[model samples]
Target chain A: MDFRINDEQRQMRETAQEFFEDREVLERARERIDGEDVVDDLWDDLSEMDYPALTVPLEHGGLGDDVLYLSLLLEEAGRVALPAPLPETLAFGAFVLDELGSDAQKEQFLPAIADGDQRLSFALYESGQESLPRDIQLAATPTDDGYRLDGTKTLVPFGEQVDTIVVAARTGSGTGMDGVSLFLVDAERVDSEPQDTLDRTRPAAKLHFDDFEIGENALLGTEGEAGPTLQKAMDRYTVATCAMTVGAASRAVEMSSDYGSQREQFDKPIGQFQAVKHRIADMWMATQAARSLTYYAAWALENDEPDAARAVSEAKLFCSEQLTQVFADDIHNHGGMGFTSEHDGHIYFKQAKAWETFLGTPTEHLDRIADSHEL
Target chain B: MDFEYTEDQERFRQELREWLRENLPDGWQAGERPGTDDPEENVEFLLDWQRTLNDGGWAGLHWPEEYGGADASLLEQVIYNQETARVDAPARINAVGIDFVGPTLMELGTDEQKERFLPKIISGEELWCQGYSEPDAGSDLASLSLSAERNGDEFLLNGQKVWTSYAHVADWCFLLTRTDDSGPKHHGITVFLVDMDQEGIQTEPIHQITDETDFNEVFFDDAVAREEHIVGEIDEGWEVAMTLSAFEHSMSDVFSIEQRWRSLVEFCQEHERDGTPLAEHTHVRRELARLHTRIQAGKLTHYRNVSKQMETGVPGPEGSMDKVFNNQTEKKLENFARRLLGANNALWTDGPDDGQWVTDLLMPYGKMIAGGTKDVQRNIIAERVLGLPKDD
Candidate 1:
């Protein structure tokens, strides 16, 4: 009944953790950078292992699992500090295709992702990173036999390499979240390339759609009805993202506790000190509370919970804000050695920096919650 | 992680609702309780009804067994209140005794005090008022100049407590006084339970905005309180006050509020001006819808509290959070009701049965101001919940 990973997902997580353990996970993460997006061999290894197929429907070359399965996969990604977009591209990419894409699009696109034949990334954020689908500004106007889209999309995750780009755009003049539609234009059709984002390991781009042409088949879901669909997709994505951040924070707290226990100051391990112990205790409680909310969010999304958006936003914002301090303090608690290149602390520290703003930052997520509650 | 209530708990919820319907007195159930300004309003009858509840084993749900309480489960307590208030049963007669003094006594009072005071509270034989503030010590409560000095086997108490709600009628007062002159302001205090009918106890009633003289300034001159009457360790009254204040802040009366909302809703739809039902307006509908949502959020906040208490066993910082949500929501509901009721609000703005829309709105200001201020709750969060650096 709790919002937690089930037995199968737990087992799957351990397996993935083992995979990263063998690959010298830290080494691979450190080797990667912004432009290069160091997910080279990892993506193949994942596809060969059929990890990408877990959340994809069986008809689309996957194990026919639910959002719960994707949560576990994201947790695995967090634990290993793997510099990859499997959690975003595979989990999110597959979900959009299943929910909003037509039968043809699912058949034509999902199997390639499931079979490791192609990589896909979603580009939902318009310029200024509008967190809510209703506020999207990218406009797609009707044309002869197709549509002509002219808009700029920022914060498009992994925009460079992915072959599929799921885009949300305005189809009508209705303001503030209505009259919107979702389309899956070919990534090659996008006129812009990936922009160098703050977190080099995870590339996001500003997509400039100048006279971008799409056939009638490219329209995803119903016209002027993409807001709800995009919301549905965002719920799954936000929950899964929160799942990753929770794992990363849990790891940070654990690593800090371990280091504090073993590293001594003045004649004993620093962990025994009241100041250090109390902080660790507080962090443990925060981690547990954040985990509870995040897992609940996953359950709500997977179970078609009616309040999914509210729960998802609450969870995402909580974890996003909590993880930043949990790890930042981990560095503080380590004193000096924690900052050295040899230390594993940087992995979480870097992940926190990237995640703090991912999927529209903590403040934006909080506004969604405030709005939902009519605050 | 699980938010589902157990089947037994759910069943108790239903039974409680039914029992509240059948057992409660008619006027008390409407809890549109008459104002004290009108003695004919029969508020005394509501007090008697409270005793009926105590007799029915429904009172003191949160108290320990030793205190004549059933020591009910937290969920059961919530359900009992939710049911009682849903039906608009009159509020308990002595809020100070039940919510404030009773809990503080259970926590820090001596065994003899528990035996002497507990049964009387349950039987409604004794009502309690707080004497925490003097004229000058209003918000800076610890600066209270009330003195309690050792005089043989008893202490001679002399203080003037202002804004003592219902002091004119209370049987006893939970009084805070300065017991020492040598130490820190917080260190030299003691809490005592003093009989209101003592030799030198006198009260002067003060009329408030609602034209009720239920509140007064109580003066104590050489009042004698036995050593056994002191609650908690001597010279450590601040600690007891802080703990009691925490409960005073976060503990929400969700069960009671549900009924208030219902009554407010009923009042709006039942009365009208011109030819239209007052509830027909779009603005009213939207406001009610928003109020319902806030109530839902408040309910969820309380549920989270239950889950937390289940996890932590004792309420911690979240107590402040509950306080913040309930007080804020109550104020909003009051304002919402006032706007919906319109000019009808002005008609009863002075009567005993005056439409509570305006009263409810004014009451919110008091709710947030009393127990603890809004800023204090935020400070608790910023310090205790957020782990921020305290202001030096």
Candidate 2:
């Protein structure tokens, strides 16, 4: 019943935060501010910590932790604004492999992530569309053994660093929420180019899968039932992204509040003014509510609630909407200094702007909510 | 984190739901109180029903059992409201006493106050009306200027309380009076339980746009109040009224909101515009689904608050969040009803077409504007919840 994070979560949060504090999540985040492909070092650290095996069963040499832990890890990655997609690799690697890829896929891919030897990513979201299922434009035609992955997956965050990718490719018709299946492909075969993005922390690439070949083991799950599995992966990713937004926005609000107090105006602390005070107050409430819901969503994910998708939507809705508002209000409350490129406010602001479209926009969530249960 | 009610709680909900289902008294769909529809028949029916509730030991769920109260659990209280609202339950016949005065008395009332007043409220013998907002004071409640000069054991009261809901129907007024002219504004107010039958007390019914004279302007012209009639401490009434207002808004939000959501759904289910039920259309379905999702989210938040109360013994400020969320949802639900029902939503009738669509749509917009406006809630959230600076 309690909304506050438990001691275990606090411990996990500290571990995750401390992990990122030690290194950039992906080398490319810091390197790619000027470079094309990000060289990731934090992945080794994450692999050392076994984050890639985060949700694998205890027998798998990875922590059998649930989405709650993953969400906390996501928050830290978000707080540090890292680029690795620890959640995607860990989640897609574990969930898809376990659910659809058969035992061999699990044995081959999970240990690499669990032992920190290799990483995995999911090529789900298509160009200009947020939905993984409803917006299934990618085609996956089958060959003698496995399927050929085609169509473009734009904005694949940290797609280049991974050893493997689980791509959602259409095997049949029924384009709405059906007609989609996932394929696991070794990235060496694809001729992909990393796309430049405003968010330096998360490097993304436009994956050009010109009829890429994958083995029969590459079909992660049921041949045509990729929609539901990708959805499950998205549940992990959305919650992860939301957790990140919560922590980052929370820090931004904190930084903004402290600045308001010490940085005075009109012969008094600027925060003493009601308008400034009220704006910060709004940010604080928004952050708290958003954080509460994100953790709750995480708990739901861990609990295996059927309503996890809705929780994902709720977390994304609150986090995305509130993060943008908090950053905007934070910047405004700090006044002129908030706009300086050197200031952290602008960094958080740009991050928030970029994230506003990452998983989905607020309207998309509202539309998703419109489709969930109550209706 | 779990939204499921306990087995016992579920059973209790079922039992009450069954009872209310069987006891769906007519004439409530038009939003008219049964007693108002036909005072003799309605009052007799309502009082008898209250007696039955009292006999079942279901009266005053939040009240301690000492004074005819049920001492119910959080889930029990919610279940009672949900079941009661589900069947409409004859408009409670005595909501003023049950929801407002009873909760206020439980919080700040002395033993004597609780003993003397609670049983009557529980038994539905005496109705109560709130006298906090004045002609000049609404959201700026502390600036209320009602005067109460002490004359020996009695206080001579003089002031006008406007927008007093159900003043014409209530037997007593829980009035707020300025006890001290010398002290600061908030510190000098005192809460009094004044009999509406007192000398120099005038009640003038104020007709609303709904053509209802339910609200009244209660005036006190040197109205007398005995020393024992004061509900709480002398010159400390503002705190009591604040507590009461908080309880009022919170209770209204939990039960009334669910009622609004259901009406919207049922309206959508039955509504038609282009020779089809509105629920059949994609946009309409999406709108309904969105509202449903928000309702579930709000329910989760409400359940969290319920859990907090179950452990902590008090509802927190998240009640404000509940109100803010529900207020807009209620409006949106109503708006959706209008869009779906169209011309059918425009007519308010006691017949089959009784303004079920129209009244349900228009009724609650004022709940947000009237109580503590949504702007105040946003401010409360900013300063209290969000740690925002005051706007001054």
lDDT (0 to 1) per candidate: 0.71, 0.72
How does chain B score by TM in each prediction? 0.89, 0.88
Q: Please state the error at residue A240 of candidate 1 in Å.
A: 5.7
What CA RMSD would candidate 1 show? 8.6
Off by over 4 Å in 2: A1-7, A14-39, A44-51, A76-80, A125-131, A134-152, A170-180, A210-213, A248-375, B26-52, B90-96, B103-108, B242-259, B343-353
lDDT of 2 by residue, B95-175 (tens): 778877888888788889888888888887887788888989888888899899989998899999998877776788888
True interface contacts retained by model 1: 0.10
Q: Which whole-number lDDT from 0 to 100 does residue A93 have in model 2?
A: 64
Best by DockQ: 2
Interface RMSD of 1: 9.4
Q: Would candidate 2 be rated incorrect, acceptable, medium or high by CAPRI criteria? A: acceptable
Q: Model 1, A242: alpha-carbon shift in Å?
A: 7.9
